[model samples]
Target: MEFFSQSLAEALSMILSMDQKLYAIIWLSLYVSFFATLFAAILGVPAGFGLAVASFKGKRAVITLVNTLLALPTVVIGLFAYAFLSRSGSLGFLGWLYTPKAIIIGQVILILPWVISLTLTAVSRIDLRYRRTALTLGATAFFASLAVLREARFGILAAVIAAFGRAIAEIGIAMMLGGNIKGFTRTMTTAMALEHNKGEFVLAVALGLVLLLVSLGMNILLQLAQGRYGERV
Candidate 1:
């Protein structure tokens, strides 16, 4: 109990002092995760929308694969990305290994499936009557798709929030791909692991607190969005 109390106090002091390295890690984490989520959203939203509106051969298989990917091991992703980014690999010319870009790439891969699957669910839940009515009113396919998307905007927001949350909390890809280098590729999760491994509980605890706060904020946003769109859903 005494040791734990001492550790907590130290953690609080470190956070209050505004440690530069800590702040750097936090910033890098946010930056990479933001871009990763953006990349995922860009690719996932359109793909999900297309999947929802179009029926074709192998659609079920694709969705199933995406669902399976949601649970993909981070280490596996790290290995796959590392292979391509490493020397002698196909993308080695880009030299992305052990960098923030590498972390972002891995995170984007991790979140893409979630975003696509969740957005697909959101789009699928939209009433077909809306699309039919839009068509009956002579709306073009593009406009009809837009109207359906607007109607399901809240659910899509939820999906995005979920993807962001997942990306922010992940450690394996960030550590393996980013190399957990201080003031560079280090993220909150990777920092926490490094600190803990070094028997430095203060920074680890502080980063953990930040991670918790981030998770809480995302959940709150999700709830508010759901509340606003409950009737529409």
Candidate 2:
């Protein structure tokens, strides 16, 4: 009991004193998560929107595949990325292994299914009338789709927030792809794991606190988005 209390106190002190290394880990975590979410959103949003509005064969199969990928383990993604980025692997010439870029790639693959699946659900929930009304008013197909997208904006935002949360909290990809390099690719989750393994509780506890706070913030944003959408409805 006494040990835990002392460790907690030291962790709080480190956080309050704004330790550079601690902040560096937090920053790298956010940076990688932000870019991964960005790329995933850019690609997933269009694909999801198409799935919601378009009529095509095998659509159910594609959606089922995406849903299945949403449950893919972080370690599996890390290993998959490692296979392509390792020195003897096919795309290894770019030398991205054990770097921030490598971590970002792994994280992107980890959360892409979340973005796409959530986006499809969001767009699917919108009434068909939204699109029909826009098209009936002589709007072009592109503009009509935009109208529906505008209506589903809040739900899509929630999806993005959720994806960022997933990317930030994952440890496997960062550890395997980034190699947990201090002051470089090290992230909050990876740093916490390393610190814990080294029998250092202060830094690990501090990073855990920061990770919880980030998660809380994401949940708050999601609730706000859902609330705003509810108000409109």
Candidate 1 lDDT trough over 10 residues, lowest sum: 224-233
lDDT of 1: 0.90
Write one digit per residue (lDDT tens) for candidate 2, span 1-233. 99989988998999999999889888989999999999999988988899888889999999999999999999999898999999999989999998899999998898888989988988988997889988999999999999888988998999999999999999999999999888888999888888889999999999998899999999999999988876665
Q: What's model 1's lDDT at 159?
A: 88
Clashing pairs in 1: none
Best by lDDT: 2
- Pick by TM-score: which candidate is best? 2
lDDT for each candidate structure: 0.90, 0.91
**How many steric clashes between backbone atoms does each model show?**
0, 0
Against the hidden reference, what TM-scores do the models get? 0.96, 0.97
Predict model 2's lDDT versus the native.
0.91
